[model samples]
Target: MSNSEITTHDPTSISRKSKKKKWSKPKKIWVSVLVVFLLFLGGAGTYAGFLYSKFDQTLNKISGSNGKTANAAFIPVATEPITILLMGIDARGDGETLNSDVIMPFTLNPITKSATLVSVPRDMEITFDGHSRKSNYVFPHYYIVDKEHAFPKTKEFWSNKLGIPIDYMVTVDFQGFREAIDVLGGIDVNVKMDMCYQDSTDGTNINLKAGQQHLDGAATLDYVRYRKSNCGTKESTDYDRNLRQQEVLDQLFSKLKSFDMVTKVTDILNVVGDNLETDISPDNLKQLILSYMNIDRGKINFIGLNGEWVSPFMVIPDEEWENAKRALKIERMRTAANPNPTIDPKTRLGTDMKSNYRSSGNNASSDSNSSKSQSSNKNTDASSKSKEKSSTGSGSKATPTPRSTNNLKSNSKSNSNQGSSGVEADDRVPKVD
Candidate 1:
């Protein structure tokens, strides 16, 4: 055979060709995969940058500044205990006075990874400007009188009253609360009883049935705001509302920490930007989120202030006030000398008292009802003692004097024709039914 015509069956050349053919497709596939992964990383980085920018802007708006500068005094550092006043304002319409329907003092201790929340009753009587008025009225009065220094004045008032140093303040109106809840697709809550209330003036209509149910934003507000049932249904007191607020907050936080929240970040940020206002600096706020992101829900303790109903006012007992103060102080203290410390159960003062107002499991409503009955009995006994003491003129302790119904009626009639900020008398105050 001719050398040129004969097939040069070189084993080495065939092996090289076979090797090239085998690896080419796989190499191309691997290169394609690497390119796709790089693209993905770039896209993710761009998205994250966008989110960070958006968060910065939102935080700036919330902190009431156009720049990145924050108040130096309000900055929260690593593992430090700080108190924040959470005020839920109720502003029905434009140009109307703002009332803080919810007054909560939240204390966070990053060292122990524990937090304490105390809900002060809106109707609790507080002395402001040398006159006694409901606690909720204090903020509105300050806002109306001095818009510029209203927040600072409010912080001062609460700090003095509670005997705790408040480091920052966060205010969210009803509209904001509703929108935030809606953004999270609603929250699961177990309504204690059938709530039916209607008010034509503010356009509030609360109608919720008893049981575990998923509530939308408006419904959740109703669940928290239902004071009295005009339709002869069961009535809920301020304490009951406080318990509900705590329950709703817990559920909302759980949802916020879930994986589903990642997709809704922008929406949530928008809602917060529009409705929420906080004094915490953007940097400190970020630090706070990072520090306590994985805090156990069980470590958070909620304390409700219970008191006797005196007509339109809730007169909190002296002992209860002292207990709340002690709990807050203890929570602010460092639990251990180490970096990571476990919260001692014995040091949690007001946690056991929390069960007196709020209960869990199937018989929650029943337990609550029983607590209410006991409270009523105590009030009756108190009333009897007050009358007896007044008649005999021989008691060392002074009973709280109930505001006269006639005076309240006259004040309301007078203020009815006035503007939103023209709440001169106690009649304009929201009364508990």
Candidate 2:
């Protein structure tokens, strides 16, 4: 309106000024409204980010439901090696307490990435520091004797005995193990021989034939625990049963990684959170899970403890136990370096091929022809062989049993020629010295 006094007070100038004022007021209103709307949108976007962060935190907490996962706080021991004690507990009741039937300290060389399973027989007569009882009963005492500290102490004792530093302990109760197997739906195992056992006292009657079989929880337990029950006279022993356990473990692992296994694995994690006891730091656990997540099926090697069942001592000796430990250590080292290394031929055979031959009664002189002839004409052949050789047993020969082959095959070829000529039913484990 003040355009040089509106050109000396002109009427047209006054109308134009009035229209300009009206248009300017609306523009200002629109600019203010737009700025307010933009501010509101920015505030909402910030709020959404905050809410999403909170939601993510809640999900993580739930995922780490287990006290172990949540409570785990680890301080790295500088340059110190990490090891794990894997315990297979055998509990027959609903109680929380457990006594491990199989105790193996698995040492992992972080540098090598190899792992070894050193089996401790339940009946071993080692000194239990806190408990004044046999070594076998120490597992249950853990619940009463500081529950948290017992297993760790046991780990220490085993470490001292084997000269290794054990950093973790993973204990799985029988129910948990069976439940894990069930979660996998089932496992496929090669039964080395017919297992027929009749035990009226335990109310267990198991009859599993030789060859491969798909096993559920109950049957899987029987396959591993067949030693307690009656197996036929085909020379199938606890060693064979241990081999079956290894197979089942492999199958269970494969099933755990399958496409259909996600839901079941989630369920399993819930169960494991409730049941498993491990000193594995949450970070390490996560790392291990991530490292092994994409691993191929055959990369992992499952092995059994090679030892004898001593009825008198009720425990396996540490001699063979040590050998097994060494073999496992080497295996772990190899596996860590290369997850997909070419496993040896004998290692592929699940059972102990050396045992098959050493247990055979054929001597160095006993060729395949003689063995066949002796089997065909038992009485006549036995008399002739007895006269030819001082030792006598129908088709089977007798030799002074060596104290220990040290895993080296017996020099007597005939004595070592028993059962399929060192070939196992399923090749998965190699013969060791």
Candidate 3:
């Protein structure tokens, strides 16, 4: 066998290949164009007639497996709800390592016809046993240790740390991300402020004008990758950059929903055939599209965990942690709870995307922060173990409120979008306007 074919499951193989192979500018362009085509598949499509045969044959070339070194189950269709970790990774200059540039969990709510993304910023500090780097590096570190098992381990780390159960993880690198956008003819979004920066070492040059504009693949990268800003009026931080990434992705999906995407289906398949990897198969992809295709963009919710800055790692407060568990539905043996739940031995803090907070004690509704106790973390007991080995808290009712980056105020619950009294949480998503 050739040297190239020797190690199928070694993480070092990526490095070896990187050193041995380098695609020319034209080849890179081709790869990008093909990948952009591949991205069109993420959106739903009806496969009847000759179209069905064509896509099926192309998808056959795209590989599927656990996308991890360890064996994991293929999550089946469920009525309760499902969570998919959409990870955007970028190759380090050396190509030996890849960092998760964007980490967002897109949860599909069948009942509400909505999807909520609880994005974890790459810089969110969490202890990874002995070492603690940005949350994003976890993927690369694990991948290097064991290529096949890396993904499962990465999933487990976040699951354990955040107290949220993740059903599946879909990883796409920066190259694929850029190409995908370019192929889709780019995306239009409203940039909150002017951004200007340059990093020759990494080949990142971000110079975007503030306000609404169109961004191609490279500019999309610039827009999202931009964490620092020259604009004095704007807040330049990891959190804001993450918000931009989510906004761009949301806009991208909105644009891709058109019939025009159908033309790019074949090219999309081949491009992503290599660039994208997930435990989910092509069939699973199709099932997802069919299942959550009607998601209301307006009801799409975003929640960010509020953390107390600890020297190196951002320590989660107890109240926030409980609220997070309640928001994500990991507290009970609910459909979305971890299959084998283990109480996190390490003590920490939490809250989530919609800024939803479910207290272990209260079910009362408060329209404003004034009605709520300002005593600061009333039932939030840092010493007490979570309700169970799991973080279930059914007593906490959902109340819709404005999202907060700081304390993550207001649990938004919608009567119109009734969720599983037992499985799903509040879905009274605020209008995006």
Candidate 4:
């Protein structure tokens, strides 16, 4: 049962008058928040330093799987890519079981000004410390096991899964997402159909009419978060929900360009800061803004792992899961450094797996060097073959990307900024009876 279920008394029969009264306060709060967003845009450089000092206080540092500090994993070079894991958590202020409703490994290449954003389905299963569960719990479970070094353990599993290094991570709370959107005076989007749903237990009351219209923060939440629709025609399907999330993101950023962002930057920062936790330093944020801020919207790549699109939970294919990792630049194309002659060097995704894995399966960072030494005879022999890419002509470079028959789309034109406006944060009510 959801935490809301435990709290709300007779949710279905709750007063409609109360929900209407609730709307008045959020509108006022969002207006104030929107003013801050513009102020933030108007003078980012001037305030970046001051904000950095305060933002530094929010850092939740943890060592990487390779034993390097999270900050140490960054590669500022224009050519080399950097990866960031984005977590969208669904938990109100109360002490509910916090699950990652969304997980996206976002990659950026500074030189090419490109991005590869892979949204890992929350229902996809992943192995963590010999225990397999849905990937969404990877962090929350670790946070419970060892809060101080939770990220390290979680990062290790993903690192092995992807075959690439993750530089940083940012977690966004759902409430903050609502606040941010509401403050921006809601977002304008085209609605494909009428959406009406309510859940007393989860405190979700989503009811929006069909067609193009401006959605307030409350309506905006329903616009993106509603995966089940009463209007039928697969309105509530996961695939369509993902598309809606991306659409809201694209529209939100598109609207930012016309705003006068010089009134209240600090306030907006405060509103958002409280809801986020990340290891990315303030300096790095500034560096990204100055160097990689003007990212080409067209170049942003959306990645989805191939899986059995089972309702609510997707049984993702193994190699396709690995392919999603490579899209994040975790699994790199094999160079001469690889000793595993069985795998082809040009193959993408999980091509040249890992080198430092040992037979005992203890890839502990403390004994990383030793693990590599004992694995000299690892993997299948040279007889194993890998899938190869075909080119139209000779002298053409084979793209190292693995085969993925999944959804892929990029953001539309927008204001130049360092942040990836791909993922819309998540929070869902129980299925309406």
Candidate 5:
């Protein structure tokens, strides 16, 4: 058989293709302790850094069976890799551009590292034109300054303000957030108390038991946002709720790892994709999968912004936020210190792909190299041909393209930012859940 014919022979190829097209298929697997997402104060300390490392490894193992391809892996065909900037907006009643509660930019370096999640506090006070305003309110200046390009505009403003880069954006409204969690059969969270609180803007009356329980949309809303009221009864502060949100994310991630979770993810994505806007395309996702396939779960990293809030300028104040801006810019770009000292890159899969890419690209085009390439091609062709023959005799499709190594990222967006605003030092929730 000719090289092309021989390469078409493997049944493994068909199986692989089937698997790829059905990448989102539901599985029977169930992993409950998803750790990456933790409430900023509670769960964040434990999961953020380590969980991402493990998740990367998991992806690598999954992609190993599919042999790596050189040209088609992750390098975008038409453009540079995309960086998705996701925001969780908290818009209250009758609010428009001025109300973005949660502002975090998730940067995916489509080449080697997995997606980077960077969280910015809503209370950050920024100086736009001449007046000062909450960081959440800075979206208006971003939108106004560059009306034609939402993602770039928002990213540029935040990146410049925070001294980082904001590439693409995906902003979700409140309704989308609620629906996503609910569709995932209500995430499992560990609440510390039978909390009760009322929010006048969203008209939320939240009450839940303290302990490990499954939380529906409504309960999660209350659990995540519940801060003690001013009378010193309820905990209130972005610091307090950060970890809670992370916990919800951890649970959701764990759930997404399951086969049933696959169905839910598809459902959620379909339901809210339009609500979520982003510069990352399906191609970007494919590349991420390729790189993520090699990262070891233990090598993933996370960095926390360590700063106190200070009052100086506006509704929120600029001093504390200014300090935070200075402290957090590097961490936002995933250049933060590797919290786990023992985390090794060689052990992870994503890092391997990056290393491989470097090594492969460094080669010269020579006669010896050409011969070796031919030999490798021959072996691959033989394997594929064998599979193809089996499949055809058994009444099946042709050989399939293997699933390449790629990183994975699960995202959600908030609608608006309207609730309380102010700054205080050590604002992070003090305990881990």
Candidate 6:
């Protein structure tokens, strides 16, 4: 054979060429896959880092510029009990005085994974700064007087009233509340009654039918804030408002614990950063989330302190006040002893509101007697009305005594005309008359 033909038919060279071709194709494929995978990993890492940075920044903003790392009197530790005061500020109007109409003292026991929420009435009379005014006005009064020490003053006021350390304070404006709910795609609320109210001042027009329905931000606000209805519906008392607030909050908590919230964290953080203010440190806040993210909703007790409507003030009866204190104390003791404790729901300390405010109209009927007892109590002196004995007692069943005829007559007239203006008057500002 000729040399060229021999070279072409060489078995060794042919085998080598075939081997090279076979290896090169597979190698290119694997290299391409590896390059793509590395790019993906790098991109993921960058996104994660970005989220982390955003989270940190948002937390810092929520914590405010108080230069406080943790509570001065109480530091949140793992598996311990902590109390936080949540204040919902009513900032419906621009440059309007801020009033914390919704005041709830929340206690969380990490050991037992139980929580206690106590709602304070907005119109509850309290003495602060050498004057007697509604509790809701305290924050706004301080905010206008001493802007720098507003929160601190407010926290001190509530801590003394609740007789708890109150480790942290979280204040969220109405705008923030609305935005957060909207970001969560609204919430599910059982509307208790047909609500219809309108206000041209704040652009508020609330019309909601009673039913198991889905409420958006505006509707939810209207639901919680339906004090006086212009459409002949029954006016809502502070107690009713408190119950609605608790209901909305319970639903909100459930949504927060959902898997869907993971994707919406950034949006929530953005809203919170803009409108929410808290003294909780970023680290402890993160720790709280990690610890109680899966807390049982059934273990949470919602306690609303109801009392007789004495004009602008809702004077809590001695028995109801003491029962609330006992319930809160017992919750702390039970959780400290055991993670899960069997407690009766009728004791006012339980998760169910068997002894809720509305069902105990007898307590309201004895307003005169309760008021007398409250006035006589050494703790209820002019010097200090917030400090009372932490005594436990059964609800009072005293016979209904006649209230002041003049006061009742005047209050009745006021109630009938409360909705005439289409907006509830701010009690913080004194009338010019």
By TM-score, the best candidate is 1
Return the TM-score for each candidate structure: 0.65, 0.54, 0.62, 0.61, 0.52, 0.64
| Every candidate's lDDT | 0.57, 0.42, 0.50, 0.48, 0.41, 0.54
- Superposed on all Cα atoms, the candidates' RMSDs to the truth, in angstroms, are 21.7, 27.7, 14.5, 14.6, 21.6, 21.1
lDDT ranking from best candidate downward = 1, 6, 3, 4, 2, 5
**Which tens-of-lDDT digit does each residue in 272-390 have in candidate 4?**
63455555433355455454545556666777654654322344655665556645553222223441124333554322321111112323342112123223222311112221223
Clashing pairs in 6: none
Poorly placed runs, candidate 5 (over 4 Å): 1-83, 95-98, 110-112, 140-147, 228-232, 293-299, 309-433
lDDT of 6 at 234: 77
**How close to the true structure is residue 47 of candidate 5, measured as C-alpha lDDT?**
32
- Candidate 1, residues 1-433, lDDT tens digits: the string is 2323322111001110111122222122222222222122223333334444455554444334323322224444456787878888776744264667899998888777678999998887554432346778766665555544455556655654554666777777777678778988998887878999888887888889989999999999999878877899988889988998988887776665544554565465454432445555445655565456446677888999887665456667656676786777677765567523344534432212111111111221201122343443344446546555675686443322323333555534544443343222353343321
Worst lDDT run of 10 residues, candidate 1, spans 10-19
Residue-wise lDDT of candidate 3 within 1-433, one digit each (tens)?
2323322221212332222233322222223332332233334333222354444444443323211222334555435466667787676465554767678766665555556666676666443322224566667766655565665555554544444455667777677667767777898888777888776766767888878898898999888888654444353666667677768767776665666765665455444433555654345554554455544566566766556433222334555545554455432233333433344544332322222222211222211121122221223222122432233466644332222335422212332232232211211111111
Off by over 4 Å in 3: 1-72, 78-80, 110-112, 229-235, 306-324, 330-433
Q: Whose TM-score is higher: candidate 2's or candidate 6's?
A: 6
| Candidate 3 global lDDT | 0.50
Candidate 2 segments whose C-alpha is farther than 4 A from its true place: 1-81, 94-97, 109-113, 124-135, 196-205, 230-236, 270-273, 291-303, 314-319, 325-433
> Could you tell which candidate, 1 or 5, scores higher by lDDT?
1
Clashes of each: 0, 22, 21, 8, 75, 0
In the range 79-183, model 2's lDDT, one tens digit per residue, is 223456677755443343254555666544334433444545444433232111223454454434444445444544444434344455666656556666776
Clashing pairs in 1: none
Give the higher-lDDT candidate: 2 or 4: 4
